[model samples]
Target: MDFFRIDLSFWLQLQFSARVALRLPAAPRSLRERTFLVPNPILGVFLHWLGGLASGSFYVPYRRVKHWAWETYWLVGGFFSWIIAPWLLALLLTRDLFAVLRE
Candidate 1:
């Protein structure tokens, strides 16, 4: 397959995964819950869209990189972006970064 298809597939998977997490009873609550203890579907949707765009945009840079095996570059970049970046970001955003992974 092509890069766009691969990137979009990963993005959709992440979106679906995040949706499942938000449905959990102990989802760090939400940005809404942190301050007001109320859920906001609007904010959730916006955040989802923002994440989608950010992921797609980050993948764009890989499109310009050439002369390397697709499998090689894709795996390396995907490992850093999907795994490493998320782990660090989760640590910064939530104190319980390992909670969801443990579930």
Candidate 2:
């Protein structure tokens, strides 16, 4: 069975009670497979998305540019990605960006 399907089943069983018995599939066998099992898959997925957004902007240049030389485009894009994007997002998302940054 799919890993996420198994996780969803577990989550729903917990939510509605064991009376909603699913034929829980055999647990993953190997250590690597077992490593993905979480007590709460919803929080796990949301945290993964939050991590992705925190590390975003890597693909900005690749998507928007086709003509500029490698170093030129990357320098410009990296400047915006590393320097401008975080501050811009912080300002837009927070009520007290400057105070938060002071820490």
Candidate 3:
């Protein structure tokens, strides 16, 4: 159903955003030395919010996609967002992206 699709999209976006956030480098020492509003933490929060908004509205743009069935566009976008992009990003950020999978 539409509700289930939306929920799945939201959860997938949250997971992807969390992975991206956790992979980010630590804040600069000068910034970290501050007592409040640490840069990286704040950045993570902002990115999460933006991701949530994008996820909620993902179907809107897909709706306008011409010559493609709903399932086709949704699957294509989901594949890129949830799998391909994550794989490529993880490879760049982590020394061995598959190391976590070995366990």
- TM-scores for all candidates? 0.45, 0.40, 0.44
Q: What shift in Å separates residue 103 of candidate 1 from its native position after superposition?
A: 12
Ranking according to TM-score, highest score first: 1, 3, 2
Q: Which stretches of candidate 1 lie over 4 Å from their true place?
A: 1-37, 94-103
Residues 1-103, model 3: lDDT tens digits:
2322232211122236446533334556664443432246776899999999988977777656787987898799889889999889989998876887785
Q: Would you list the clashing residue pairs of candidate 1?
A: none
Encode model 1's per-residue lDDT on 1-103: one tens digit a residue. 1322222211122236446532323333242233222356998999999989987786576776777788978798889988998788888998676786788
Task: Find the candidate with the highest lDDT and give its number.
Answer: 3
Better of 2 and 3 by lDDT: 3
lDDT (C-alpha) at residue 93 in model 3: 93
TM-score, candidate 3, is 0.44
The lDDT-based order of candidates, best leading, equals: 3, 2, 1
Query: Candidate 2 lDDT, tens digit per residue, 5-96?
Result: 34332232333465666554554455223434446788889999988985685655476576767897779877987899888998899999
Q: Candidate 3: where are CA atoms >4 Å away?
A: 1-41, 56-64
* Candidate that beats the other on TM-score, 1 or 3, i.e. the better one: 1
Task: List the global CA lDDT of all models.
Answer: 0.62, 0.65, 0.66
Off by over 4 Å in 2: 1-40, 43-65
Q: What is the lDDT of residue 100 in candidate 2?
A: 86
